[model samples]
Target: MRTAYGVETVRATERQLMARLPEGTLMQRAAAGLAVASADLLGRVYGSRVVLLVGSGDNGGDALYAGARLARRGAGVTALLLAPERAHAGGLAALRRAGGTTVHSPAGGRAAGATEGAADRPAGGSASDPAERPAGGPAGPTAAEVLIERADLVLDGIVGIGGKGGLRPDAARLAEAAERSRAAVIAVDLPSGVDADTGQVHGAAIRADLTVTFGTHKPGLLIDPARDFAGTVRLVDIGLDLPEEPALEALQHADVARLLPVPGPESDKYRRGVVGIAAGSARYPGAAVLAVAGALHGGAGAVRYVGPAGDAVLARFPETLVSDLGPAKAGRVQSWVVGPGAGDDAATVAQVLEADVPVLIDADGLRLADRDTVRARTALTLMTPHAGEAAALLGVARAEVEGARLSAVRELAARYRATVLLKGSTTLVAAEEGAVRVNATGTSWLATAGSGDVLSGLAGSLLAAGLPARDAGSVAAYLHGLAGRYAADGAPVGAQDVAKAIARAWRDVRD
Candidate 1:
């Protein structure tokens, strides 16, 4: 499992490490990593045009130091100072000593870069002083903007994890110019203007090509909105001794393989556990068929399905023990999967909640089931809701749920008193307690119709095989996402196709 900590926890660890180490040791380590990564990205350090957006913080120090290393290696480096006087004093001196030049994104500018923090002058520089001139240098901040536009790489140190809210007008304008540049933008730790604790992007923010985080992973790098702004993430270990518990976790292939249920020599059809699926209807018989298709691949020994689409389900999986007598008379099952395509079937949804086995609820089941009734259940209950469904449960707009997916998923789990999975760009599974798991798999093509139905059946089957609600939901999400990616390849795929690819995903994980 890959873990991420919130900004406070990271700060606490940083303080602990800093207290024991010599002054500036941590910064030097961070700078070394950043410089190495910058060089790797540039391929050839010499002759590379590197631009650094220097703010008044340690993050700026990190960028400046890295730029100094590059400058010493024969690269033409320029630092565009957001706070000319307040920039890291040591970092500025080092860059200047390494044949690097400095410019200022001074307040106000021509209408060209004036959207947010527009500078007053053109991209020019004041590097005429013997100690301030860059190699192949141009004069001042006006020239710096053009350097930014023509540079091979741009290091965004405008703001760090501690900074909050949107970008100031001048910063926003620079962010815009950075985007227009063909340079591969690399954020020092995190993109400026994004919340470090929560992955929320309030206003204009730097969208980086790669974010080289120091010490530990930040929660914002793992969650969305902010995560979206953070293109690809690369961790640079500065050796901070963090705590055991994490704020969030992502399951790797090895973790998933360990969680998978494999049949033993003594395994029998009934011994492996049976999954009861209460889904589909006359209106959408395909929902039932697709749900069973997924359940059939789940590690369950047998599947007992109860709903109006009994015939449709059995027609597709011939192995399912189909029943039209509802969940109460669905015989014995280790776990139950409710909702999906069951439109207006509140009674059936209620009956499944009373079962002694673990229950996984989805789709219309989330709408039809009583909130108090689900919370009162003694057995494990897993609720899966997309942003829209989660929004209804939380009494907020869908945009609100999607914007703060981590908070929204945690709230849903706490309020419903069950493990909750909020599906979207990042599939999150949160238990009433413990670190949340973010699904890093899947493709945009997986957003097609009936995908959730397949997810419900697979997770429910895992519950029958005895995984806890949290594990069941997260593992199922992992497999479902991988399957969707495999099935989609580079094109659109139906839910059934995703269902069929579950075994392939399982094989891929185990191998």
Candidate 2:
């Protein structure tokens, strides 16, 4: 599992490490890593042009020092100081000594890169949108514009992890220009203008080709919105002893492989656990078919399906044991999966809730199940809801739930006394307490019809196999995401394709 820490914890750890080292030892260590990462991206550094968007913090100092290293290695490096008076004194002098120059980008300075009465120089491209071609400044091309246009690399040090409230106007403009430029933008630590603790991005933020973070991964680097801005993240160890508990965690292949339930010599169909799938209706038999399709591949020994779509399910997967009766008469099952497309079947949902087995509720079940009764259940209850369903359960707007997905999942899990899985661009599984697991796998193509139904059956089977509510939900999501990726190798795919790919994903993880 990959773990990520929040801002306060990261800061405390850094302070301790800094105290033991020399005055600038930690900074130098970080600078060395940053410089190395930058050099690798630049490839041929001899005549490469590098631009550093310097701010008023150690983040900027790290960039300046790294720029000095590049200058020494025969690269033309320039520092665009957003605040010259507050810039790191040591770093500024080091740059000058290494034949690099610094220019103050005062708020009201002419758009053109000029020295007033000083020597005339070309300007880099004035800040603009990253997606467009480099547009010349109003007064033709300025020195700043020219530098940015010709630069092979740009380092973003505008805001550090400690900063708050999104981007200031000037910072936003520069970030936009850097992104618009042809250079590969590299962010120091986390991306600028992002909430390091919450993974929230507001106003304008730097979109880097890569982010060189120090010591450990920050929460923002792992979560979305901010995570989207942080293209690819590379962690550099500056040697800080961190705590075991992280603000967030992501399961890797090894973690999932260990949790997978494999058949053994002593195991029989009954010993392996039977998953009871109560889904679909007269109107939508496809929901039952898709759900059963997923269950067959989810490590379950047998699936006892009780619903209106028995004929459709048996047609696609004859392995499924179909019954026309309700969940109460579905015989014995280790776990029950209620909802999916059982539209208006409040009575069926109520019956499954009383089954005394771990139950996974999704789709219509989320809408039909009584909140008070669900909370009263003794066994593990896993609720999988997309943003819309989750919002209704929490009695809030969909936007509210989506804006703070981490908080929403936790809140729903705590209130309902169940494990909650919020599915979206960034799928999260949260228990009533502890750190949430952010799904590391998936493709946008997974957002098709009946996809959630497929996920419900897979997760329910894991629950039947004796995985706890949290593990079952998270593991299912991880495999589901990988399956989505495999099924849609860049093209659109249906729920059946994702279901078919689940076995491939499971085996790939084991191998």
Candidate 3:
């Protein structure tokens, strides 16, 4: 499992570690790692031009120290200080000592890079100073913008993790310039202007090609919106003694493999467990077929499907035990998956809710299932909803749920007193407590029609096989995502195609 700590926990851990170590030791450690990552990105640093968007915080220090390291390696490094008066004094000294010049932008005007060791140089150097500008360089663009535009690499240190509500206007301009530039942008710790704890990007933020995080993974680095801004993430261990419990956890292949249910030789079909899928109305029969298709590969011994679409399901999967009876009389099913094109069948949703076995609610079930009944259930309940369904349940706008997925999933899980799997660009499974599991295997290709139906059946089967709600949801999402990848292979694919690819995903996980 890849774990991520909340900002408070990370800060607390950093404080404790810093108290024991020599002053500035921790920053140096972070700087060394940042420099290494920066150097690796600037392959052949000898002639590379590196630009640092320096802020007033420790992040700026990290960039400055890293810039010094690059400067020492024969890279032409320039620091564009957003707040020159408040820049890290030690870092500025280090950069100057390493032969890197600083460009201070005051009032958003053009400024030339100050000459090294020029004690009397104005805050913004004269544009006529040939020492800073390239000989006869284009005159219109600010020196800061020119430096950013022409650099081989740009380090975003405009804001730190603690800063919120997006970047200041001046800093925003630098970020915009970096985005327009051809240089590969590297953000220190995480992309600036994203909420570290919630993965929310409120306004203008840095979009980096790579984010070098220190000590531990921030919640923002793993979740979306903010996660999208952060390109590839690289974790550098600065040796802070973090707590065991993480705010968020992402299951890797090994973790998913361990959680997957594998039957023993003595196990019979009945012993393997049966999943009951109470879904599909006459209006939408394909939903049933797709659900059953996914359930068949979901480690369950058998699938008992009860709905109006029995004939449609039987036509595709003859192995499914189809019945017209309601979910209550669907025989002895270990678990039940309700909804998925169910169309307003509130009574059936209630019947499955009344059952003692674990239940998974998805699609129309999210709308039909009563909240109080779900909250009162003694058995484990897993509710899978895309952003829209989740928004309806919470009575909030879909955009709100999409922007703050971590909080929305957790809130839904708490309100329903059930586990929730919020599906989108990044799928998340959250219970009332413990670390929220984020599914990273998902692809945008899985956004096709009936995709959630397939996920519902797979997770329901896992529940029937006796996996806890969290584990069932997490494992199902992992396999479903991998299956989507296999089915699509970078092309458009149907939900059935994704369901058909589950077996390959299962085998791949075990191996």
Query: Which of the numbered candidates is closest to the native, going by highest lDDT?
Result: 3
Per-residue lDDT tens digits of candidate 1, residues 1-511? Answer: 8889987788778878877887778888989999999999999999999999877667888899899999999999988877665567778888988999887665322211212211111122233434443222334335556777899999997778787777887677678778988998999988988887789888788999999999888888988888888998899999988889988889989999999999899998777889999998899888888888888888889999888888888778998998878888878899999899999989899899989899999999999989999889889999999999999999999999988888999999988889999998789999987459998698888998999899999998899999999999989999999999999999989999999999999999999
- Superposition TM-score, candidate 2 onto the true structure: 0.92
Report the CA-based lDDT of candidate 1 relative to the real structure. 0.85
Clashes of each: 20, 15, 0
TM-score to native of every candidate shown: 0.93, 0.92, 0.94
**What is the lDDT for 211 in model 3?**
98
lDDT of 2 by residue, 91-134 (tens): 77677789887755433322112111100111122233121122
Compared with the true structure, the alpha-carbon lDDT of candidate 3 equals: 0.86
lDDT of 3 by residue, 358-442 (tens): 9999999999999999999999999999999999999999999999999999999999999999998889999977459998897
| Candidate 3 runs further than 4 Å off | 106-140
Clashes of 1: 20
lDDT of the candidates, in the order given: 0.85, 0.83, 0.86
Checking candidate 3 for backbone clashes, the offending pairs are: none
Q: Which stretches of candidate 1 lie over 4 Å from their true place?
A: 107-143
